[model samples]
Target: MITSPIWLPATLMAGATQAWRTAVQRRVGKTLSINAAGLVRYLYGIPFALILLGGYQLLFPAPFPVLGRLFLPFCLAGGLAQIIATNLLIMAFGHRNFVVGTAYSKTEAVQGAILSFLLMGERLSTLTCAGIGCGVAGVMLLSTGGKRMGPMDFLRALGQPAAITGIASGFFFALTAIGIRRATQEVGGGDPIHAALIVLSVTVLLQTLLQGGYLALREPGEMRKVFTSWRVSGQVGFLSAMGSACWFTGFATAPVALVRIVGQIEVAFTMAFGHFYLGERMARSEAMGLMLVACGVVLALLGAL
Candidate 1:
């Protein structure tokens, strides 16, 4: 069994930084196209990711791990999935407020659990399953816009554009998580942190190439805007790198399902940022939903014990 104290703090940091990065991405989307906005994180984050990997190497003085044949494939798959997932997420944001859009995507936790089990043969404890259940329920409630609704009405709500895009985002994000974990596992020797950082750097670089190349061919004008809007895009890049480093650390150190379950705390951080930073009003039902997500986090952590 994989166990590490680093996973908890790393997941927490990932959640916090991701929330901030996503919110900033939403802002960047206002001026840029969906694909352009999505590119901001990867294209701008390359430098930060490389700097982080270099710093870690200098500090630890570990030999680089040998890359297995699967490493490049995993990075490509994970990077591409993340690019699609992020674009879908940004699209979802257009259909709803940041908090609700993100809440819907929190379904990634449950989806990650299922994908991890089927693809990687990872299993969750009953308590962890229960926690994932609670988180999904809370996310469902949040999708209702805090209004009381019948079962059928709630079901219909799930069919909304925002819900569809958000759920699709969740599915791809789950794939991304599994890919990252598997890629990290393919690394031979070296510190797990070093392995994770290497995977992160490679994944980010690949994503930059793929997404940047697409923008260059399809929308050459947006490429200029991407560089011109560096003021805000730069922040998104830095936060994305920081958040991804932590997420890769968590994935390297624990089961992807567990890491993602704890990472559901990002919803709470998203809600806080939406309300305070973005001046968005919170509904009572949203608060209730957040409470359920928090309880789920606690239960998941307990199950990890």
Candidate 2:
């Protein structure tokens, strides 16, 4: 039987790997436009994803699983949403620092709960809902950059470009999560790892084509940059593909909301990356907000159990 413990570790690892990948991708952003930097995750990752998928299939030598009725639509929608979401996030990065920008995007867990409910008909229990509430509150806290804002100020801040892009990024990422989960289930109920790999391979391929085609026409020079910096881009691709594989496996086994809530650990990992590697520090309010985020993650996991 699949247990929370089994999938929980995958979610955590995905989060950690994703934080690193985003950091690398963000650096890549400095050289390219938001669209191109966002595209790097999929474009470079395609080769590595193909290699992993091919290796798995060769080792197993199993017949391909039948795709379900909803598979194509789900996979395509998820892939497209991810492309848009990534661009929005890179835009947020341009407006804010890395840690704060990531914290803004961390609103995905709550947004995931809502999207999972609406699209997948997944229902959250009272405890799970409460955990989501805590998480959303924490996201708001982090979004404020630790400033003590009254209601009017909070509402005003939400109207800002950075906040709008950040929230929009979260909403679309939630869609990606739901769509990917549905796609994973449609692949078959047998081996989740295999199912995840199939979905990941297909989705990454589609994203590569979509983004690559766009860049080819609109930003050829940036496309050249993506290739010229293969050393760092390769690391980003490897980490992104592996992290996404873990996330897809977790989605296949767990509820999307639960998986996303658990994925909140990414914020902490991002903070650590910021502090140690980037020499960045958070304000007291930011620290307190992150603490709330930690509490929400713990509560959500306990509720899941």
Candidate 3:
């Protein structure tokens, strides 16, 4: 089995790559319909995922595992959930500021822990729980960009369209994480990385077919837009494939909750992207929040030790 130290790098890579993917997807969303933008990642990414699996097979040949019946269903569930989550996130982007919109979805770490325990029977330690709490609090603080949010303000924010969609996005994302983990387990092989890549390939294939079919049938014009905007969409697709490869590898190596908690660093990366790339300023509250998130990360690592 892979150790925590080995999985940590994969988790971090997943988070960092995903942050950039989200930014690219958000930009694509402005031009295409929400669903179409979400579809871009799956459609364009299918080729890259295939290439990854092919390259891996060539470099280190191994017999592929025969998947059980449950594998397809789990992969399908994860793919659909991710598609829904992505679309909902894009919808939230329409309703809130970018950083705040992304922050709302960071609720996934907590929800993922609960779902992992219930659905997969993975248990987390008390220290891990504390880390999740700290990380989530830090994310919330950053969400406000240093604005002092009182109880009433917080309540009101929750009632907004963006917050509602954001929370829903998190829920589906939790499902996606669990479903993918389950799928990878079902694929069952000695090589964790190889199993992960195979699962990723299958999931990407399923998503591409599902999303592409829907777009072709209902929104043919949007399909044209997706192809026409390949330059940008290509970046979203490649990044999505790379990030998900790292994520699946992490899941194959570690407990789902631990991976998700560590994955919260994506919020910090996103915050930095907002400040540096988008010319947004981080307020004092956001800085505090980032610190809290850093503390959570340290504690999480300690707990693993």
> Which is superior by TM-score, 1 or 3?
1
Per-prediction TM-score to the true structure, in the order listed = 0.99, 0.95, 0.96
Candidate number of the best lDDT: 1
RMSD of each: 0.8, 1.8, 1.4
Stretches of model 3 off by over 4 angstroms after superposition: 1-5
* lDDT ranking, best first: 1, 3, 2
Candidate 2 achieves a global lDDT of: 0.85
Q: Write model 2 residue lDDT over 41-120, tens digit each, in one string.
A: 88788888888889999998888889999998889999999999999998998887888788888888988988888877
lDDT of 3 by residue, 1-305 (tens): 33435579999999999989988888888899987999999989989999999999999987877787899999999999998998899998888767778888888989998998888788877898899999988877776757899988977878889889998998999999888888888875667788889989999899989988999999999999999999999999999999999999898888888888899889888887877766678888888988898888877777777
Model 3 CA lDDT for position 283: 85
TM-score of 3: 0.96
**Candidate 1 residue-wise lDDT, 1-305, digit = tens:** 46578989999999999999998888999999998999999988999999999999898886788999999999899999999999999999999999989988889999999999999999988998999999888888887777899999888988999999999999999999999998998898847788889999999999989999999999999999999999999999999999999999999999999999999999989988998888888899998998899989999999989
Q: What's the count of clashing pairs in each model shown?
A: 0, 0, 0
Alpha carbon lDDT of each predicted model: 0.92, 0.85, 0.87
